[model samples]
Each structure stands twice: as C-alpha cells, then as structure tokens.
Target: MAQRSPLDLPEGDPFGPDNLPYGVFTTSDAPHLRKIGVRYGAHVLDAGAAAATAASPHAELLGASSLNPLMAAGRPVWQAVRAELRDWLTNPAHRHAIEPLMHPLTTLALHLPIEVADYVDFFASEHHASNAGKIFRPDGDALTPNWKHMPIGYHGRAGTVLVSGSPIVRPHGQRLPPAEAPASPAPASAAPTPAAPSPSASSAPPRPVFGPSLRLDFEAEVAFVVGAPSPLNTPLPLAGFHDHVFGVCLLNDWSARDIQSWEYRPLGPFLGKSFATSLAAWITPLDALAAARTAPPARDVPPLPYLDDAAAEPGGFDLRIEVAVNGHTVSRPPFSAMYWTAAQQLAHLTVNGASLRTGDVFASGTVSGPRPDELGCLLELTWGGRDPLHLPHGTRTFLEDGDEVTLTAWAPGPDGVRIGMGEVTGHVVPAAS
Candidate 1:
C-alpha cells in the first residue's frame, strides 16, 4: 500500500516528517537479525533501502546491524543520510517502493542505538546541587568552592547500560539504619534465633541490616552521544562541540539513597549508581533540534578560559522532561533550566586531553527547576526523605518493590510542531536472595 498523499498523522505525531530519529529495530518476520531504520508516523523506514533508492554510497554503511559504522563515518555521511531519510518520507515519487519497506513500531522491537564506548554522569544542575548541600550538610554553604569553576563529573559503569523496557532488579547493598530506628537490623537471609526471655535480652538493640534498598529512587536527565572521535591531547573547544557530538537522548540514572549516602562520603558513587542505567533507543540528530536551542541559565561566576568560548553561541536545549511512577505524573523537570550547557560539559570533559571514542555517552546531572514540583528525584522532592510525596495510590518516601518508573521528553520544532524522545522505562523487582 503506497502513501497516496501527505500521510494524515495523529495530533502530536512524534515521528512526523520534520522529526526523523534513527534507531535499530527487529520485526516479527526478522527476529534474528537487527536493522537500522528512521522513524516516521507510527512506522520505521528501512534506512538501507532508502539509501539504495537514493543511489548513495552510504547504502552499504546503513545496511549494518548497528549505527556505529555510520556514526564513525563522521559529519559528511551523517548529514547526507539525514537528507536522504527526509526526502524518502516526503517525496511522492518514491512512495510505492518505500511503503513496503516501512514497519509499524507496534510490531517491532527497538534496541540501543549505539554500543556505548564509555559512560559519564555529571552534577551540572546548580538547583539540584544546592538542594543536596542543604539536605545533607545544612551547616555549611550550599555551593561547593570549585563547583562553579568547572563541570563536575565521574566515570560510570558502561557494562550495565540497558535498553528501555528491560527489568531493573532491585539492587541489594549494605546500608546504615536511621538514627531513630533500631541500632541493628537482622540479616535478610537468616531466620531470627529466639533470644532469652530475660528483660536484658529483650531490650538489647538490633544491629545494622543487609537487604534490598529502602530508599530506591529515579533521576530524570538528558544525555548526549559522541559520533565523531577525537584524539588524545587534542581538546574539543566549545565551538566544535556539535562537530563531535552526533545527537541527544533521554537517560535515567537510577539511584539508591541509602547506599549512596553511606558510600559517597569519602569518594563518589559506587554500587549505588553502577547497578543500572537506562536509555531511550532513538538518536535525534543535532541538526533536527535547531529551534530547541536556548541560552544557559544566568551564571553567577564566569567559567574557566578553555571551558567557555565567546565566539560559540548559547547552546542549552529547550527540552521538557517528565517522570512518572506507575502511570501517575509526579515531577516535570525543565531541561532548559540547567545551569551548565552540553557544550560546556563536553569541553570540560576533554580539557585535560582525554580522547573521546565513537560511542561515548555522558549525561546532564539531574534536571531541576525553581518550582517545588520541578525536583527530579525522590531525594529532593521529598527533602531527603523528610517529606513524603502523596500520590493517588498512597504516600511514598522512596520507590517500593513492583513500582515502575519512566522518563520521557519533548522539544519544540518549527510551526508549533514538537519532537519527542522515546521513553525509557524500567520496573523494580525484588532483590537477590
């Protein structure tokens, strides 16, 4: 069936002609092999066939099961593929041959777009940082001394990067009990032995526990993917950020507050964060986000010389990110409100001459706004477990077993149009025995 006219799409069609994102997919007919495709109205166009029909040399590159080959081809090939993909969807002459190649998203499965070479998560949001300082260390100043000087980030575990819809097993780790709670918690796996009936035996306090995390949480964030590689000792200037970065997507850096607070005191995140990180499949090219760019929030302290270049334009994206738990809307974080821009983060990352690989993935720290409801995670929204959030089902201090969390986002396009970032969702199940 050929598309007779301009395809009549839904009111808020995510894959309209203007927003053609790329990802790997597998259909019911071809479950064994994966193929790359560009998104359209409720359908995915075979990028390989589209490239072949356009008589482009990149056709063979697009036929690969992964986007890494095309990504390594750099700016020129990426631009050409984007142009050809848009033409195939809009050009009426190619309708009949192309229609058969397109597959509905409902009948297909989307996988991770790029095989991540490395992973990093940053603490770039001042609002989020301020809240943390106040909640954890109310006596000292909220802003740390060197926080304004540069972007703060740490390397994360890339081996555990999972695609959307994957089950997130509730991680079990050692955690400290609250001050007011029992002195010690019984072992999770061991059955409690009966103590003496004497008064002293009954009054003895319990010991610390090892069980599933009591304060599991979710962080709503945005991350950028590196398509163009850079050599060691060759820093990426702020002006050349777009040249190195291929595109942006949504990320969920799941957290366990109890494990983090106890372990992050001397260093940074460990088992608390490395257990799992979720990402959306589609990779929205930077060129398609022209209208979504905006200026970074006002800076109280100017950045270092190499991190900010005056010639480079303001570069924050106007993407609205949302977090939902079990189908109920809880927090709506404004991605545009981030204090540090993606370019600044990219420049700071490589300022020390760290070379970038083809599929390096780094995330913007949790996005939070000035409003109370703008908080990105339960730790902030509930004031470090001081205030419990009241939901339709019940009140929640932290994520409970069986709760599912999802992160989704959208950006502005031309003529009142909007583009979407495919959602990343994961369900929390019981921890290991």
Candidate 2:
C-alpha cells in the first residue's frame, strides 16, 4: 500500500499512520446527530453536510450522521460511508469541497462510536494466560485442558462499557476480613508463662462482613468492534473471519479482585468484571490497518485441526500496544503474544450456531507476560499485593481514587507514517454512598 505524503498530512491527512482510526465528531457551529464527520490530522470531513450540499442521494442517511445512527444501519451503510469518505479525502477536487467543513481534531470530544449489543472477553494471549494461570494455579498446570483446544471467553456486561474520559467509580463489595484484626491482647499473665485459653473460647475478631472492597484494580486489553452481523444458525469459518470484523480499539477492563475471588467460583466473573470497561473514543477501520497486518508466532502443542488456518490470513497485527497508570509506562510490548487469533475467536463464538449482532464486542483478556512489569492487572503484577509495585507516582498494589489509567497503540509500517489507535483514559472515583 502507498504511504501518504507529508504534504498531504498538513491538510487533515486521513492516511497518516498515527490517525488511522475512523471516528465521528461534530463542531459547535453545527451541532446535531444529523451533522457528523470523520477526522484526519487537523481536518474533519463533514460527510452528512458535504453530501447534502453536493445533492448526493445518500445525504439523508448521512444526515442523522453520528456514529450511533450509522452503526444502527449495520455493515452496508458503514462500508458506504467509508468508501465515499476515502475517495473524498484522497482526491484533490473533492478536497476543496470537503475542506470548508474541516475543524481542528483537538476541538471535539468523542461519543460512543457504536451502540454495543453484547460484549464478550476472550483469553487470546498465550503469555497472559500462562502468567495468569501461574498466579491462579501455581505449581505445574498453566492451562486448563480446554484452553489449547479453543478460544476461551466469557460474556461481559455490555451496558457497563463506557467511552474514554468517564470517571471510574470505586466499586463497593465484599472483602476478606483484614488479617484477623490484630487479635486482642491476652490478659496479663501472673507468671512468666500462663495457661493459654481454649482455641474455641479464645475469642477472635468477628469474621469480616460484606462491604465495599479496598482492593480495586485495572485490566488492559484490546477490543474489536463487530461491523457485520451473522444469523443465529450461521457458522463463520476461520479462513473468512476478517469479513465480520469492522475495526479495533484499546480497552481497559477494570476489576475488583476481592469481589472476583469471592464470587467467581463455579461461574466466571460477574459483578467483579461487570462494573465498568473503558474504550478509546475512536475506531480504527480494518481497511486502514491492512498494511500493518502480519502473522503471529507459531503455536505450541499444535492447535486442533478445526482451529487451524495454516496462515490463510494474517493472524497478527503489527500494532505495538502500551499501558500506563498515573503517567507511568507499564507494558511497551507487541501484540504478537496472543495465542489465539481474532478469526479463531469469532469462529469459536459461532461454532455452536450462536448469532452475532453488528454492535457486539469482544475483549482480549489480560495481555500479560513472563515479566512482572508486563503483567496486565495488579492481581498478577503484585502477586495479589503480597508485593506492591513501586511506581514513579508511588507504591501501589491496586488502583486508588484519582489514579488515572491510559492505553495507547501504534503500528510502524513500511509506509513512512505510523498508524496509531488513539487512547482511552479514566481516573478512579470514590464509591457511591
């Protein structure tokens, strides 16, 4: 693919590597759902207004132009908008017509690009899985028998997913009793050594009660947006998985380890994970990312034949993902550590003939690694806070109020400019009374 020239970058360069993700934003001058546009560098391509002035028939659809309505229209409309926008941004003649609507990218705040119907999280990273497993079940086994066979995942609360900048409330829930509340001192002994009280009679502090948790934490992962829809009985093949994917974004899956440990026994994560998940404001289209696609490292134990694609399509992305807390960089690694590919994740979702919706979402669970610093969540990072992480901000075992967490990603391609996924940021909030 040809890279965008630096000259083109000055005038809202849509092809710039850092601004690859497609998003919808509006200016204060024309504010309404009917007025929306895609961004590039310093420009905002007003799709709805431009199409209206040009007397284009599709102008009506573009009219109710925010991403919410566009997304409701499904894959057909998404492609239509992308195709038209691509031509206008890339051509000189259309550039003049669209330039009038260009607004500073820094001026607008982002809204949830799509109306999510359901959200699912997957254990896609091998390093993360192994690291997490070692924390959960240390000794020998790193994976459950079913893990190597398929992409394991759980359904998440779609309503809890929020856009960037939303304040994360401190979650209130049950916690283990604080280390026996420093057992009461025994009565002064008459002699050097006195008889000890009976174990049962020896009163100890009452067991801890259900209340707000103090051990709150954050989880960093990648999320993919579903553009197309598949019927309930349909089965999507691994070889053709990309057809269903619309784009990708950075996600922060917030967690309350104490609540999880107590509730996630037979069933998977519930209130612990269902509270809040933050996503970047913009959505990076799959087409814009074509140049950054690459194959992942070979799998160990050889995946089952049903899950194997044998390199039919790119199984990995060149994107370099990073995570930070309170302005401190945590992970500066690549996305290649994922054991299962997105195609496999989607294929597994539909193997049972389950239906998928256009606004559905899936998160790659805790993209941790061998090193302690590379761990995605505090649970594994601090070994349950038996050890606390010393950060530039200060020492922390888990997130505290006013703590800010941010996620950034970029891919350096043969094309001179780098393509980047913006960022998602949020600060912890005190629990509601």
Candidate 3:
C-alpha cells in the first residue's frame, strides 16, 4: 500500500489506490440498478461484481445496492473489506481478474448511500456560534449559558435528507409583517412597498403574513455516518467515535431564516429546517482519513466528565470546506476551528439513554472561522442581512431564486496524500404558491 502499485491512478489525485472511498453508483447502461462500488482514481470498481467473480465470501455485502448491511456488521468487517479491496487493486496476481469490474466514474450516477435513520445538527463551531449570537441576539451573550456545558443540537427531519444533485425548493411560510403597516392594506397594484412609517407608530405587534421565505440560506457542514447501533440506556464514550462512525461526507443543511425566526421561540426548529437537507454520495471511511486527524482548538470551558476526554484521541480534522453559490466561491470555512469535537457530539446524543441506529447522520454546524471571510453561511456573512454579500455576478442579502449552492471539502490523507470528501450541491427553485 505504501509504494505505487498496478492501478493507474494519478499520484496526486485524492482518490488514489490508498484512498478507496465507497459509494453506491450505477452506469447509464444499467440505470435502473445500483451496485456497491469503491473508487480508484478516475474509475469505480464494482465491488459487488469483483467479489462475485473473485470468489470472495464478502461478495453479498460488497455487491449490495446500499451500504447498510455492511455497516451493521461493525468495524471488523469494515476493516477486512478495505484491506481486501486494497490488495485486489494493487496485487499483480489479482489485477487480471479485477480489471473488467472497474468502470470510469464519469459514466455512473451516484445515489444516497444509506437510509437515514436519524439526523442531528450541532452548533459546534465557537466562531459560528458567537457570530450567530451577535447577529441574531444582540442583547444576549454570544454563547448561551448552557452552550459550554453541553453540545447544543436539535433533531432534524431525516425523511427530507436528499442526495447531492437534488433540487432545493425555496420554502413558503409565515413571516411577521412590518410594525408600521396600516390597518387597511392597499391592493398590490396600488402599493407594493409598505407605506412610509408615521412619526407616531402603533404599539401593537405586527401580524403574520404567509408566503415564500424571503431569507433562504445555506449552511456548509461536515457530517459523519454512524456505522453501528447502540443499545438504549447505553452511551458511546469519546474513545468510540471512530469505531462507531464509519465515514464522513459533505452536508448542506438548508434553512429558511424568516420562517425559523418566527417559529423557534419556545421549541426548536420544525418546518423551517425539516424541509430538506443535502448530502454527498460517497462515504470516505474514517480509517482512510488518518492523516487528517489533529488536535482541536483549546476549549475555553471544560465539558462535563461524560463528554470530556482531553487525553483521548485526536479530535479535529484538517479539512478545508469551501462554499460556492452560482459558481462563485463565497467562503472557505475552517473545520478545525470547531470548539467541540465529533466525539463530544456523539456522546451527548446518546447520553440521555437514546439509542443510535446505523446510518444516523450528525453534522458539525456551520464551520465559520474567526475571520469575516471565513463565515460559513449567509446569516453570518451578511450579518443578519444588514450587510449584503457582493458576488461576482451579483449581490445577495440572502439566496435568490436560481441560486445553486455547493459544499465541498478535502483533507490530508496519508502524509502528503489528500482525500476528497466529495461535494453536496443543490440548486434553489422558486417556492410553490
């Protein structure tokens, strides 16, 4: 595995022989069918097909359309298959038999790799959290009272989880009307903008208006796919993060800011967040990302005993996450700036005696850094819409219709090697009336 092998992958390509990220793909020739495939440079090895002809017992797991069955088998099976694939692709003795199973990746279609059992999103980046507080709650502390003590998160709608190329429908919902609007509203032709505010304004609260969201936004995030399930009343310690987390992928947690602000007073987000989420196709195993591991930023407040393990394992990834809207690069947020680690989030998710099922997805919320240019979402970058973001083609206070947002990431693989986490991209369409 160390030296260059028989595979024709470019030396510097992220998906080289040493990095065989797995995904579910199908060629145009067999559009209706999907088979498990492992990437090797520009090609995808039909693992299921290779296993069948190679007389490997793991063929059934490798050949399956989805990775769920293999995930449930736990770590040993995952390690074994990875080793086998590496050997089969590199060994001279096996190349002749494995060549026919490899297909150019460009000719295939990638689909959702697993059935999402649950989805949790965490506000783990201190920079992002601080900016959110300053922008959304100017009078309150940047970090909440309980924020440092726990990894704050909310359960997102798992059913709305979509694959990479899915279309994002701009959500329609209720927003508070201006406090200065007259008691009697004029017709659309008569008046489009709200009437000029009188010197003396009403003390009453504004009424709610229903329509498409005016403040649609995107959050660039990194999500991990849980590989195995944990029993009820049991918790996974910090040390078991990589053990239970099979792999990582790019995630775009789409949001409707106006709708979310109106509804998230007592309880957390519901429709504003539940509409849709996008994920990348490939799940690059955590094992393949050994070179990316690094020590996370020093914590300002130590967490409780259950979630704290300073001497444990490396907790941060050196991944560079970039956000693109309509082919314009908006930000390059730093994932390593996160104040909380994936281990902590996993521990807190199950600390309440909740069970974790295979395919559970959890994301490290918007990975904004300390710099203004490092902001991860429009809410932060635009400073709650007070300042508009200047783009190459145009300006955006928030996302406009036809805006295509994409999130992509890369991390240090093995020494000088780099691995691609793939991209989760979606185009925004006008909201349905």
lDDT of 1 at 293: 89
Deviating ranges (above 4 Å) for candidate 3: 1-6, 178-202
- Tens digits of per-residue lDDT, candidate 3, 1-433, equal 5744336676698887667888999888889798998988878899998888878879999888899989888999999999889988988898888877888878889999898999999888888877776654556577667778888888888999999999999998876665533322111010012223445455555568988888888988999999989999998889878778989888988888777766665566777788999999888988988888889898778878998878888888888999999988999998988888899999999998999999999998878899988999888888877788889878898899999998888898776888988888999999886
lDDT string for model 1 (264-330, tens) is 5445688788899998888888887888988888787877788764556878899998899998989
Off by over 4 Å in 1: 1-12, 179-208
Candidate 3 TM-score, true structure as reference: 0.92
TM-score against native, each model: 0.91, 0.85, 0.92
- Please say which candidate is ahead in lDDT: 1 or 2: 1
Which should have the higher lDDT, number 2 or number 3?
A: 3
Could you tell me how far off, in angstroms, the CA of residue 217 lies in candidate 1 after the best superposition?
A: 0.6
lDDT of 2 by residue, 239-306 (tens): 65666777888888888777666556456677777899998777887666777778866777677666
Better structure of 1 and 3 per lDDT? 3
Better of 1 and 3 by TM-score: 3
